[model samples]
Target: IVHGAKRVPQDAVSDQCPEPDGFFADAEQCDKYYQCSDGHITEKLCPDGMVFNDYSTEYEKCDLPFNIDCSARSKLQSPQPSEHCPRKHGYFAHETHNVCDKFYFCVDGKYNMITCPDGLVYNENAGICSWPDEAKRNGCSSEEVFQFQCPKVDEAVAATHPRYADPEDCQYFYVCINGDTPRRNGCKLGQVFDDQSKKCDWARNVPECADWYKGRLTDVQLAELENPPTPRPRATKVSKRKHQRPRAGDDILV
Candidate 1:
């Protein structure tokens, strides 16, 4: 337990007697630590994500762990290790307790996963794990079954694609390899967009419309008919102001 005068780094109890209980600066800032009478401070650096819990008698650095095994626990009722947890959802309990030095946990699960996030691997030095984007999860892959193959696509195609394939064909339909829905769509100023698929019921969007015109059809064309705009109601006076002349009864004989 930490108490009285602070302990010195390297665990040399302060011969000077009692030290402060909480955060105190050090002659050497290699790392500021809570000193115990024992004076032993940790050599490993506390990582960015970690936090130190200061007890009246001691200070301890804690972090989550990696490399979890879900079945490691002996039974459901056994006391859990601080390293591992048994959350109810979102994650599985590695054990009643945790074993790793630094790892993430969730209220739902003892461990977010036995491993870690899908992309990031772990780095012992940095005390974190990361992965290369465009690794397995990134770049083009054959896993997806598009209606048509992208010969060589650019931004417009990316934005428009089979639904929008550049200015020339963004509104037109094409066939994707998967044969789900035809990769065809178009936007019009009004409803009943086109006779292409009898899909011309109405335009769902107006990318080039004015503020007032937006969400409204420009004209009353058959395929694009919209309800006429209603004017705002004007205010009406409930009563006229008092007459400037004296009251009729008072002025009768004046």
Candidate 2:
């Protein structure tokens, strides 16, 4: 102002600077402007999902406390947690749940459970396969029905009963019993449970392995085997019968 003729006088006043708004524009730019020694930088801010904190400032980089909830997430997302057979493959290993707290078992060989009608049972308490008594009262089985899966195992077992292909092992059973409970008894593959004794008794007239099939052998199969047909060897000592008859004949004079 002293050197130039048009300049203002030495006593002129200057405009004041504006106060800062709360925003930092960018934490990177702020950090370049201000820094203090003491391991603390005066300016910087972390973005959302994060906290602008002292630990970040000390470390000279933002440290994100991970928002992860390790406990809330489970490793067992595959089968979902279950009460019975907790292991999960592509197929469920056990019944999930159904009537009451009891597990609703899937019918065998399918590796899944029968989805019972919601309010009722999951399996037949009658112990028959899909032979529902109430369903029978409605005449479910009385109608003309073919023998279910009869030929498959019987044909397969003819080769070698147990050694090659047994009917029971082929993921199915052969029950000769049909329709309602019989007055005599009924036969199931590899079993015959007596309702009277509540035991696995035998079916009458059915030929089974190891014995004659006079039918269900409800008593007990004798474990002691009969001896082989070979005859006993010669007698070892004098016979009492040999001594008896000779007394009257040889001692007749006396």
Candidate 3:
């Protein structure tokens, strides 16, 4: 909630209370604001990684940079950094060059490490997990991480987003966007990706992937997952509706 404060004397009042019992923002700093009560102005600052929301004088609010525009008042408070937290709040990428999936989420100088979903990497620019191709990190590109290249295909097939089976892992496959950009994907447990049909099916249905889960899962385990017994439905009770008398404030429906 970023707004331009009128250069008018009423809104731009700084260093002194413009009116009694109200809040005011500092003209030059996004994080600095003032609280005025009984004609006394007291300086205040928003927490690190947040900007002052100066949309209202009756209430004071601080919000994240994503929700506030600070082009006019870009100045912020001094950073209160801590271990793994650069400014007391925000998402940060892992320090390791090759560790693309892990990152840190910091709040108030404390850190919580997070891992991206499979086949995705942490995108520092957007502060969220995204595709490796989109993350654009030098050592974290899809090819560098997956070690697989998209096979050359005609424009017709490329435009359809072709799916290819992983050569090393029968349960996994690669989705080639425009026949160039590759993204890794996988079949569900107890199933394998079928290149011919471009879908997941029971391992026994795909000869090439019949032994895909051989060492990882026993035959009995795979059988149970493929053909698990269904559970009985639970009994439910339906309550009967009762007539109610009209109340003074209740609206009667015809």
CA RMSD for every model?
14.8, 29.8, 8.0
TM-score of every model? 0.23, 0.15, 0.72
Candidate 3 on 143-206: residue-level lDDT in tens? 9889999999999999999999999888899999999999999998999999999999999999
State the lDDT of candidate 2 residue by residue for 127-208, as single tens digits.
2234332324222231212123223345444343222112322212223333222112223443444333333433442234
The 10-residue segment of model 2 with minimum total lDDT is 1-10
Candidate 1 lands at a TM-score of 0.23
Model 1 agreement with the true structure over 133-234: per-residue lDDT tens digits: 112222212222122444445555445433323223323334322322223344443442333442333443333212323434344552334554677899
> Which residue segments of model 2 deviate by more than 4 Å?
1-121, 124-148, 152-166, 169-173, 176-208, 211-254
Q: In terms of TM-score, which candidate is strongest?
A: 3
- Alpha-carbon local distance difference test for all models: 0.33, 0.28, 0.84
Runs of candidate 3 with Cα error greater than 4 angstroms are 1-29, 33-43, 53-59, 66-74, 233-254
Q: Between candidates 1 and 2, which one is better according to TM-score?
A: 1
Ranking by TM-score: 3, 1, 2
Minimum summed lDDT over a 10-residue window in model 1 is located at: 132-141
